[model samples]
Target: MASRQMQAAQIVEFNKPYQLSQVPVPQCGDHDLLVQVYAAGFCHSDLQVLRGQFGAALPLIPSHEPAGKIAQVGTQVKGSWKVGDRIGVLNFKNACGQCVGCRQRLRRTKRTDPRFCRKRQTAGFKHDGAFGQFMLADPNTTVHLPEKVSFEQGAPLMCAGATVWGALQKLKPDVKPGEAVAIIGIGGLGQLGIQFAKAMGYRTVAIDNRHEGRRLAVDVSEILKPDLVIDSSAPDASDQILDFTAGEGLAGAVVCTDSIEANAWSLQQLGNGGVMVPVGLPQDRWQFDSEAMVFRELTIRGVYVASMGEVEEMLKVVAHHDISSHITTVDFDQIPSIVERYADKSMKGRLVVQITQ
Candidate 1:
């Protein structure tokens, strides 16, 4: 029989439009699962990869956020996973168990999780990703999609949701319930961050400079909406935050935007000894006020995507809270145009491409 083929949007060259081509369906490895993708989410990192910022190899299938049903299972894949199982695949693939990151006792430690294994081939980055009809997914990092969540919502949750959720998890040790927490930048990640913080029992504040972001923050349902929304561009934005917190300042803040100014301003909103977690990846180095750091003894923690266990936990919380992802769903053929439009950074929420019903 002829080799099975599937249509995929591939980056034929750097700084060029993706070519939608018919490619052979990838076979599952001993430890992999073949997923028939239903929805794929577009992220800022995809733009960076396309611009050659990460030096990704050419002819790549771009998109790290993928959710779908299992089509096939590997021979060695021993688990409940089987055909037609709803799932969300994390970007990180096979991790080397011998690496320091993998051997570490604490998975939450900075850059020490198995997901950080240097030898790992990340989906959408080092390996073929989810912009295709079918993709190979690592069973270890994959999570079961809750019945309440749709494919479109689950797709972005693989990256954007996991990212912000992990960032908030870092603050739990120091920050407590009823204490104020600010989600800076109210874009794709920030929108979820606010809801997650609220669900986690924190007094969530939504901060944004853009009209679309600010609007999104206020538009969420009453239960999941931010307790306070502030315009970061306003001169008294800091004062407004302090007033909401009764002048104590935020207990913690999650910086969700790539803008340097937003990152810097997020730190200023934190009270003495407050923690600041930056989830956004900015190309430029971030500069901070060393004097404030020394006197306030504030903590700045860097976080990446959540571990498999955390992603599963996040899904439970998402389902229990009835959290929803604001998304714009488009057909798979529109991937090129969607990518081009995403360059303007005007998208309000997550953008997902529906590959199948």
Candidate 2:
């Protein structure tokens, strides 16, 4: 029998529009699942790839956040995973089982953690991603989306959702119930962070410069009940944050923007011995006060994505808290316009492509 062909959108050249073409359906390898993508999210990383910011290889399929139903299951995949199962794909598409990240995590944590693996490749960059009819997914990185969550909501959870969840997880044990944490950048990731921080019982403060961002932060404060929403563009921004926290300063802060200045200020807003978790990557290197970091004993940490276990845990939290992504849906062919909106800073919320039913 001839192989099946599926439609996909690919970046044929850097700084150019994606070419929509038909490609063969990816075969399901052992420990892999073939998913008929229902929805795929548009991310800043995808924009970076289009603009040649990361120098990623050419002809790559962008959009790492995808959710769909299983069309085929590898023979090695056991029990619950079967054709027709609703699932979401993780960025860590696959990791070598022999790598330290996989083996050590399996032994110690009783789970497969791909974050530490050197050979692990993300779905959108290293392999074919889900801006298509079908995508091959590693079983280890796939998570079951809850029944109530729509494909659009579940898709962003794979990337933006997981990223913030992993960053917030670093606050455990240190951030007490009444302590405050500030989220800088009220975009897609920051919005989710606000929801999660509030649900986790932390006094949440949101910071952003755009009037829309400040408005969204205040909306979060009203809906999710965050403690304060500051306009970071204000000259007295840092003072406002300190004042809100009663001069003790934030117990910790998550830098969700790619601005180097925002990152530096995020570190400065932290109280003594506070943790600064940076989730976004900047084109330029971040320069902070070395002496202040040493004197305050502050810790700077970068969280990329959650481990496999962490993804599952985050899904549970989303389900329990009824968390959802604020998104606008577009057809698969509308990516170029969305990219333009992204470049012009006009996109109000996350953009998700409806790939298939």
| Top candidate (lDDT) | 1
Among these predictions, the greatest TM-score belongs to 1
Candidate 1 C-alpha lDDT tens digits along 205-321 = 998888888898876778988988889989999999989989988899999988898898889888998999998877799988888788888999988778898999999999999
**Which residue pairs does candidate 1 place in steric collision?**
none
Question: lDDT for each of the candidates?
Answer: 0.89, 0.84
Per-residue alpha-carbon lDDT of candidate 2 for residues 256-348, written as tens digits (9 for 90 to 100): 888998899888998888888998888789888898799888888878787667889988888888877678898987876768766566566
Candidate 1 achieves a global lDDT of 0.89
Q: What's the TM-score of every candidate structure?
A: 0.96, 0.95
Poorly placed runs, candidate 1 (over 4 Å): 105-113, 344-346
Task: Find the number of clashing residue pairs for candidate 2.
Answer: 0
C-alpha-based local distance difference test score of model 2: 0.84
